[model samples]
Target: MSAAPEVKSADANDRANAISTIVLGFAADPMARWAWSDPSEYLRIMPRFVNAFGGRAFEYGTAYVTEGARAAALWLPPGVEPDEAEMDAIMEESLRPEIAGDIGAIMKGMAEHHPLEPHWYLPLIAADPTWIGQGLGTLLMKHALRRCDEEGIAAYLESSNPRNISLYERHGFKIVGRIQSGSSPVVTPMLRPAS
Candidate 1:
């Protein structure tokens, strides 16, 4: 396949944009968004996630920075290849009460019960609000999907709201579960096979 546009890899320069994209994505729902609403907190927690997840966390992201103007983004970590049991345990452990109040407790509980293997959660993805409907989200998603597909892997993520769920469905993700965050357990969780 012809290569996609020359997108930039997530780096220090892109951290602010990346963090902003993440916040906006989560901001769709007030409760779940609070976890990382603060930019400084987002930075602190991201590295901790990377350390725990063996880089499955988005210490770096893929972005079509030029055309989309920071529209396309996905915070996915690398290393330790995706594994199911380990991921739930990791996600559950990370969600412990020590992590955050009600949010952590709920996620930790869900992780213990979560059934899936090697699920690669997007955690966050958002095109510039003004840039939606122009395929920027797909552009970024395809980049990661293609990479994961090459490894014959499947992935997963939970959208902050139903509207975004459609965007994910249109992009080939399937609704695997419905997540009602403890503070506000209304968001839907979805999954997709890498393509």
Candidate 2:
């Protein structure tokens, strides 16, 4: 694989690029596809959905992107998880009310596996679909994992794509639990303890 791209802390100038990168990179993701079913529909609502959940990561936590904004990773510091009311509002507004129950049940089931102890969280990470397997994701993950190690903090995430599980596992994350409610795509929650 080519060397990982240079990693930089995202600035205000990078927010829009970062968000666009997420929507585009995740366009074919299993969970995303499951939620929207139709490609056009998924493209339409993905931004609002990403903004609702991943916006806080940029505002209150940390966001990292490669040169040219080709890839990105959004990390949340301990205690910075989204507010329940805000998330609920976003879902109600951005998603069809029909899928609300399924969404709710999926989230609730996923939450059951979260570690109670303080930890950093990775809600989303993506390379432009064109850049996958070039090691950008690994570089971005190491940048954040280094900080987690410095603070002796654990890290957590729910992997929506089975294909990425091994990549995360290579970084020391272990699958702790799985949630599969109704016809929703499986979400595997993973945790990596402080090294």
- What are the candidates' C-alpha RMSDs? 6.2, 2.0
**TM-score of each candidate?**
0.63, 0.92
lDDT of 2 by residue, 68-166 (tens): 888998898998875567667766766666777888998898778878999998888998898887788899999999999999999999999999999
> What lDDT would candidate 2 get against the real structure?
0.85
**Which residue pairs in candidate 2 have backbone atoms (N, alpha carbon, C) closer than 3 angstroms, thus clashing?**
none
Which residue pairs show backbone clashes in model 1? 83-118, 84-117, 84-118, 180-185, 181-185
* Global Cα lDDT for candidate 1: 0.55
- When summed lDDT is taken over every stretch of 10 residues in candidate 2, the lowest stretch is 82-91
Model 2 misplacement above 4 A: 1-4, 94-98
Q: By lDDT, who's the top model here? A: 2
Per-model tally of clashing residue pairs: 5, 0
Give residue 59's lDDT in candidate 1 (0 to 100): 46
* Cα error of candidate 1 at position 14, Å: 1.3
Error of 1 at 103 (Å): 2.1
